[model samples]
Target: PCPQHRERALARQARLTKPPGSLGRLEGVAVELAALQASDRPDLDAVAITVFAADHGVCAEGVSAFPQAVTGQMIANFVTGGAAISVLARHLDARLEVVNLGTVAPPPVSDGVVDETIAPGTDNLAVRPAMSPEQLDAALAAGDRAAARAAEAGARLFVGGEMGIGNTTSASAVACALLGKPARSLTGPGTGLDRYGVGRKVAVIERALRRHADPRDPLQALASVGGFEIAALAGAFIGAAARGLVVLVDGFIVTVAALAAVRLRPELRPWLVFSHQSAEPGHVRLLQTLEAEPLLCLDLRLGEGSGAALAVPLLRQACALHNEMATFEDAGVQDRS
Candidate 1:
């Protein structure tokens, strides 16, 4: 359906009195958005960044080098306008919102932070389910509500980021489940883990997989090892797409959540623009599965929407070119090619 609309947009672009292909990828991106919105004149009014914070039980397995407290600390950093996402959001001139999906420790009082915790922390997946079905539903509802609020605030674009220690482990497990791959194939050194730390992370994931490998229920698999913030991010993807908002996907962990959203609703794929390919091993596999080509490849592995936030300027430039570029006929330039 998008391709059909895109075809019409391309025809319109060609007849705009311009030499074909003068605008390069900007033309293509604009045409794609025109198809997505079914409008020849597409606009990106405002950008919103949602950072979902949660704590993973797998951190108890020594899978991440960072302490679980770091999740809450980073939330504070986000509120205080000191984190990478804070600076990136400022650079993009986008509004930032933080959601306390679930953190191990009590969050500090801060402006622009929404308290929507599903639980204090997930159960250790090495031994039990990370969250119950009710908790997952609540997390998804929280995301939906947040997206509604952002949409009401006139945000046309959204970026999904995460702030949870050991979340990479949860992301890896979700990727393994979705791709039907071994944990070793998807595992990477998260948060600057050493060789032994990497091994420990892989082993923990493998053990969790062995403990719960049934493929009949994807959500069940997620609940067995995924984090609340991850489920909420997945929900945000669904909510954004359902509301016809453009979604900018971040790095590996966010991609896993996007994959989960795709699994839940295949139609949501068209609204997504992947931001970057991360150094995380599972990221490539997930991107390939989604048939997504990222806009950047800076070897970035940090979460917090650092890559998506960085790519917003480029997207804005694309929009500018689409709306403002001069046609060859208007400029009196001959199309010799």
Candidate 2:
């Protein structure tokens, strides 16, 4: 965190017309940006949003409401600019890069799709490691390379999104491994799973967690119980911090990835800004684990960086208030403090 920029922002905020701390989280958002950018004021002109699409073998275990084929279909939908995130990206005028990490049915080469297929899909974590070590390394590299490209394009903020069927199941299992919790506690109804389906998902997660009992090893936990997209999201967060880019994390699944990344590099915590609280049952626990105070609480469950993209305007408003609001002297008003 930029200590000097934080102090300067606080001092400047005191001189503004509003009462101290009136802006609530908005004020905090401004301070966080100032610290990240190492400036008294911050802006988000060049932002990059990357949506990583993949499939989870756990879908074979009847964990997800949607079939695995939807993974590749959604990637095609994204490329054609029809998905929710696609519209949001265009509305924000942000660069949207869709990566085909490893879908069950890989899309043909086309616009807006980056080919980084590591495998057709991960092995079912219920019975084996989701990915081999080599595949894990390759997924991380894909995410790292994606973030580097964003940085090279002059993106000051990187909003990492993901699309994968049965990913919530995988993320819950990873959380169970990392946090030493029961699968039942972390499992939720993903993609319209009913209570019975949720119970089945829990059982599958329990199986994966039982296989990999070492919570001390984050990478092992991820490889044992994570999906390709989740691993890439973790890698992207690390890479963004490496490039000094401010990261705005999305919903439950993305936050799960960030948690793993934070466990890997605790120093990356300050560079992260959680966008919103997802309605997914386990998201609250993940956010609490990160000690993150999200900027919005719309109960968003959409995972395609929609929550994060929606909050960008709020960040812009925070910056506008911090940078454009006049001081007491400018307005010829008496200082309250």
Candidate 3:
């Protein structure tokens, strides 16, 4: 974040033809984005959205309501512009990239998807480590490459999405480990699981937590309980921040990824703009932990960066108001005498 740009934006906001703080959070949003983009007037015209798709081995634990094959199927849906994020991306005219980290059942035609599969999928995290050190590194690298692509495409904002069956369970486990909270506290009915299924998911996460002792290490926790898409989202966020792009974090799974990335590099926190509060039980806690105030909260649990995509308009509007709105002097308005 640039202090100079922030100061300039603040000064300009004070001169706008409105009462001080009249625009509420939008005023702050514009200033913060100005700081993040190192510009007195920042815009989200070039937004890059990358949806990382993978299969989670924990699906074997019967965690999700959907089949593991849905992960791959959704990847196809993303390219075909059938998914929610796909439609949002087109609506916003943002650049959307889909990455295939790994899946047991892959799409028949992956023409638009970036292939970065570390394996068929991670090992069942309940019984074994989800990813080896090498695989984790590969996933992080894949995310970094995606970020590089976004930067090359002149993206000012980066939105990361994930598609992986059983990923909510994996994300819950990772969040539990990172936050030192109980699995039951973070676990939720992913993909519309019933109460019993939620309880079962909690039990599975508890087992994985017990197996992976010393959850203090972020990298270790991710390797033990994280999904490929989760790790990749973390990496892409860090990568995006390094290149001076504002990151709009998505739902629960993506929030966990943001947590992991912030733990790895605390400096990256300022660059992150949480998009919304997810319907997932753990998401509120995660937001509390991060001290994040999202732009919206419409009970969104579907990932694929849909929430972030939705928030883009807010950021754009904020910038528009900041840059185009008349100042007191320009509008010939009376000052508060």
The most accurate candidate by lDDT is: 3
TM-score-wise, the better of 2 and 3 is: 3
lDDT over C-alpha atoms for residue 33 of model 2: 94
Of the candidates shown, which would achieve the greatest TM-score relative to the real structure?
3
Q: In model 2, where do residues sit more than 4 Å from their true spots? A: none
Backbone atom clashes (below 3 Å) for every candidate: 0, 0, 0
Where does model 3 exceed 4 Å of error? none
What is the full ranking by TM-score, best candidate first?
3, 2, 1
For model 2, residues 44-89, the per-residue Cα lDDT tens digits are 8788999998899988899887777888888989989889999999
* C-alpha lDDT score of every prediction, in listed order: 0.84, 0.90, 0.94
The 10 consecutive residues of candidate 2 with the worst lDDT sum are 103-112
Candidate 3 on 93-135: residue-level lDDT in tens?
9999999999999886699999998999999999999999999
lDDT of 2 at 285: 95
lDDT of 1 by residue, 1-337 (tens): 2677788777766755566787676677788777776665666659989999989888888888888888888899998989999998887778899999878877665566899977788988888888898998988888887778778788878898998999999888888877779988899987789889888988888888777757425587678888888889889989988887889999999998998888988899989989899988778888999999888999998999898998888787777666666656777776656
lDDT-wise, the better of 1 and 2 is: 2
